[model samples]
Target: MSSLYDLAGPADAGAPGPSDPSDPSDPSGARDVVAFARVAAAAGLGARWPGQVALLGPGAAGAAAGSLLGGAVEPASLDLSAVLDRSAAGGLVDVEFDDAAAVRAGLACGGRASILVQPIGALPPEVLSALAHRRPTAVLTRLDDPALPTRAPAPPGDPAYGDPDSPDSLARSLLERGEPADAVAETASGRMLVSVYVPAPHLVVVGSGALATALGAQLALLGWSSAEVTGLDDALAAVDALGPGDGVLMVDHSADVDGPVLARALRGGVGYVAALGSRRTQAARRERLRAIGVDEASIERLRGPAGLDIGSRTPAEIAVAIVAEMLSVRASTSGAALRDTTGHLNAGRP
Candidate 1:
């Protein structure tokens, strides 16, 4: 069987051609969804087929495949030839894997998983757009009515899913927890499969120095992306372009460069905004920001002195600490050590 990457197209094709968006180097996985949507559209799957095509994998890992679009499922290990044929006909199939079979299927463990091989017409265009843009999104599928699933952007203030009185409030809560995994949620209406998709964290590093270089390398090692900028225009543009799952790190201590960028990021929806400075420098920066009319609430969102107190003196060490803090913030955790905490270590993790 051919991998989805193989069937999609070349990874590095020239502009205007379909290419493998599932390339490992992309990090965000947004490319995968975009490419799948493009390919599906090109093949006339949406028009020829009764409904939209997509894949829904099983477990908290969230592996799913559909008529032509593959979600998180690896198309290589599981022979999808038969599944694809069935999905093209708008048929639903429940695929279960034994322990050994699961291993062969590239799953971490084995269990009965009902892969949704149906039309995804119910999914909104906005949801798909959010996924393609590397924004947080959730797909809530009612187990009883699996054919017509609903979607919502996973940000806290989104009106579509944020109302506590909504039937899928439980699913919204799961999504708000910021866990990028599949979960079974019992709602007021029925049981639902909440599949949360979060883009890999991207950071805007505002400065060029040994510290900035180290941070870039560190982000790459973590399967994340970072862009370095020094000019105020570039810095502001990057900060403005950030989504709820991305961040900006102002490593340049210059007030002229850092002030406007920090104000923009703090007021915007960027998930994390941090800066590299000493305690005194942080105080000075705050005063400068306040003088420039930045509100107290927005200024408080800044994670100045950027990283955890990990005794990181070297540039590389600082990068590790900063990245660790960023992950902790993304996960909505206190950055405490596992030993110091009393709950399941892997709880809410994929």
Candidate 2:
């Protein structure tokens, strides 16, 4: 199914200018939401407008909405023809999907969705900038009141959170979860749609080998980004810049090089810190870290011998296992088989 990652720019002349969300021209050179925002901005939908531009809400099965610029939806797969037909004059459109309809629409489950189909812009420049720059951003929309302006995406310090029942407070709550997700909330103003966009998982690979090459391929396949660094200074810089959603994979197998980088990552906000080594190597590395003043609590965060017990041997297979483990860690799961567990299949998914 077409996802946000598969969105392409319009090809026809006079249509919204063509844009590749994964273009290398991006400053980060990573395929992220910033590229998506660039597409919307290039199409002239990032600002307030009274023209024919509209927005399709709840992007990717009610995760977040994307702009419908020049009659093209940036990141939508659902058949919005009926909704668009009804909202041709530019207004609000709410859509509800039953189990069968939702499944047909490529949604994982059935639910009701409210899509804002008006020419009125949904995102302000500040909000777009935050998303483009990989900052934690939350977009709040009043579904019931199209006349009311959509609240700008804000960080946790915004005064809008002063009101408990305000949409901004609800958005802040979602942002605090530190994961990208969207939901509908009951606010004092009315029913509001809040979507949180966080930095995509950026992995720092601190080694060079077949494994590193395989890891890069896997990261690209997942639409995530990675930086390959060998120097201790570059590695440390990458770890220090990592956000809560980012990660580090150390495969250099050098105690002197790995200890400081791993220590900094564990002590900082980097979400996943892993290393490649055997049992003896892991123990020796731990001791080295201790000698360097890394606390026990911080050291415990290291996932030495990275990757699940998938009995992988080849570089590609090991890469799969490592990437799988990284995803499990991100989801707060135990890398267990679905048949071996209970409850929702996607319970831990962001």
TM-score per model over all chains: 0.64, 0.60
> Candidate 1 residues 223-270, lDDT tens each?
577888878887886675566778888889888988888988887778
**Total residue pair clashes for candidate 2:** 2
For 1-350, candidate 2 gives per-residue lDDT tens digits of 11222222221111111232224133232222222221111211222211122233332342323443222333344344334344432344344556676566455445543344432234554554443323566666666674535666555676765878676777777777666556667866677766666665778889888988888899889867777888788788667656567789999987779989998888886788999989999999899899999999888889989999999999999999889999988888889999998999978775
Off by over 4 Å in 2: 1-71, 74-135, 141-165, 176-179, 182-193
**Number of the top candidate by TM-score?**
1
What is the Cα-based TM-score of model 2? 0.60
In model 2, what lDDT does residue 41 have?
16
User: Candidate 1: lDDT of 63?
Assistant: 42
